[model samples]
Target: MSLIYPPLQAPKRLLFGPGPSMVAPRVYQAMTQNVVGHLDPFFFQVADEIRSLLGYAYSTSNQFNLAISGTGSSGMEAAVANFTEPGMKFALLTNGFFGDRLGEMARRQGGEVVRLAKPWGEPYDPQEGREFILRERPQVVAFVQAETSTGMFNQAKPICEAAHEVDALTIADCVTSLGGMPVLVDENGIDIAYSCTQKGLGCPPGLAPMTVSPRALDRLKARKTPVQSWYLDLQLLDTFYTGHKYHHTASATLFYALREGLAMVAEEGRENRWQRHQRNHQAFVAGIEAMGLGMHVQNPAGRLWTLNTPRVPEGVDDAKVRAWLLEKRGIEIAGGFGPLAGKVFRIGLMGHGSTEDNVALILEALADALKA
Candidate 1:
């Protein structure tokens, strides 16, 4: 007996959701290149180039920078697991979902979690974060530089400074900001920073590009207990990346895609790419305001260039609007989470997806959806 399956035909969508943004044609082409064994010499050369490019992307000189063989969440887990131990004090600055997730990961690692929370869609004041860090005296301080859940961008420099004052390591989640904005891991004093390839890098979601400062690496080296996650252990990963040891099988295809994406970033110039995102974001905001819609993030400084959360109009059906956009226009925008549910639309303009054309199209489609 023979079984028949339908041919895979995925819809061509203008992804304006929180993540997995549109990939560049170059990245797709890179993925189609011939695969190599994870431990092959040729693969090692690819890995070396990726590490170098990742450092450029992260704006860091740290030799520990490399792409973890998992999604953004894996990078989160790795950062937490390596730096935390039982009964350690971990201070998390939270205002949205991803911040809360860092707290959860810390707790799972037996960290005595201390959370300093601000209202959703708001950025934490640097002074307040400093006070919290001093008061909590945590061994590790974690926060999201770009809060994807709320479309807010937090000030990282002051937070890192405060953490350092307390002799604490700072972990920054740059998943949404790395390629789109200036993460400046070294300048901001971030000890460990992790990001995803899909959102800002214009690649498929698979690799998590991460960097660890010397201070963070020293802390990891001095850990009393073994890292909880065997696969995500940084020491083991470091050995693998440094010594060409076989710790695990990493896909060469994904590495190819990541390299190609990073190459694009380098070619465009990081600052120029950031300005492009900012320009597109400003255009989107202007269009939304013209349509009589308000933004969810009130503070101009708090707003993220890549992710935009426009308030759902009063008496308008949020789900219906999202559905109509998807069904009629083939555009995919997301709804809010937790306290923000049904109150706002989470639209992303990231990487190759961030364009003047997309901004205009989405605005027009959104206007039509609202009217219908």
Candidate 2:
């Protein structure tokens, strides 16, 4: 029997989950612009604009910055596969799911993995990983600046400082922090940083905005071995983006969306954007506390402004509450992952999605769900 369906449509949802936050109407309109060929000069103009805007979004002056034609995981894998060779020691300071992901990718790249592990919800003190870096002297040191799974924010400065003392390159997972909070790529001395266009950037999921410092670019150039993945090879990709020597069929449609989103970021000003996210986050936290719920990240300073993890109340099924919120309120929030599964809810307040009214709306819906 053939299946029947109504006209294709997406259900209206208020995205309060970990990523792919609510896209602004401006970005949506940009997506509707004429799709140009990747080689078209108009496409290149948009691509060039995206490159410069990525610098501003990431707070970096690095020239080797561009959006990878894949998601955040692609960016993570590229960073690992390009930097580490066989038998090279790779130190991963992991406190959450994304950090562990980096370690696994490095190991697959033949990196000698020594992961400094911690519980899921705990934030990292940059000093805690200093001794590990000092002892290992790994060629590549990687960490997640924003632990998306647990709403914990990790500082990169001291880790970068310690890694530099040993001449080690640093890779920061800025997927959750970029555009929502401060990544401070230049100030923290991060060698390589990667993030998704979703979440903090107030765009849909498609591209991973990545940047490499001059030092990291130099390391990449001097590497004896060919980069494992041809598609993710930054040098070849750079030729396509900068030299306009078509290496792949680039998505000019997504470029339009990103260009407009970054333009919004530029107009808002980076500091103002950070403050806006933080302010909404605080309001959400206060409302949650008033509802008798506690946050998973106990340390207030380390809590992320983009993603918030609220602890599941005693005797409450996190899944049911999430389901109720979705079915009854038309709101979408996320549940915890890995070790913290069933323990917390992941609420994302990112980019244009982070607002006073959203905080109020989600809080009200959450309170009703809990009561139900």
TM-score, each model?
0.98, 0.98
- Give the least accurate 10-residue stretch of model 1, judged by summed lDDT: 118-127
lDDT of 2 by residue, 1-372 (tens): 598887999999999999889999999998888888999999888888988999998999998889999989999988998899988999999999999999999989999999888899786666678998999899999999999999999889999999999999999999999999999999999999999988988889998899999999999999989998999999999997769999888787788888888999999999999999999999999999998899999999999999999999999999999999999998899999789989999999998899999999999899999999
**lDDT score at residue 132, model 2, on the 0-100 scale:** 86
- Backbone clash pairs for candidate 2 read none
Q: What is residue 307's positional error in candidate 2, in angstroms? A: 0.5
* Candidate 1, superposed: residue stretches over 4 Å from native: none
What tens digits encode model 1's per-residue C-alpha lDDT throughout 56-156? 88899999888899999999999999999999999999999999999999989999999999888887778888999999999999999999999999999
Judged by lDDT against the true structure, how good is candidate 1? 0.92
- Misplaced by over 4 Å in model 2 are 1-7
Error of 1 at 70 (Å): 1.2
In candidate 1, how many Å is residue 51 off?
0.7
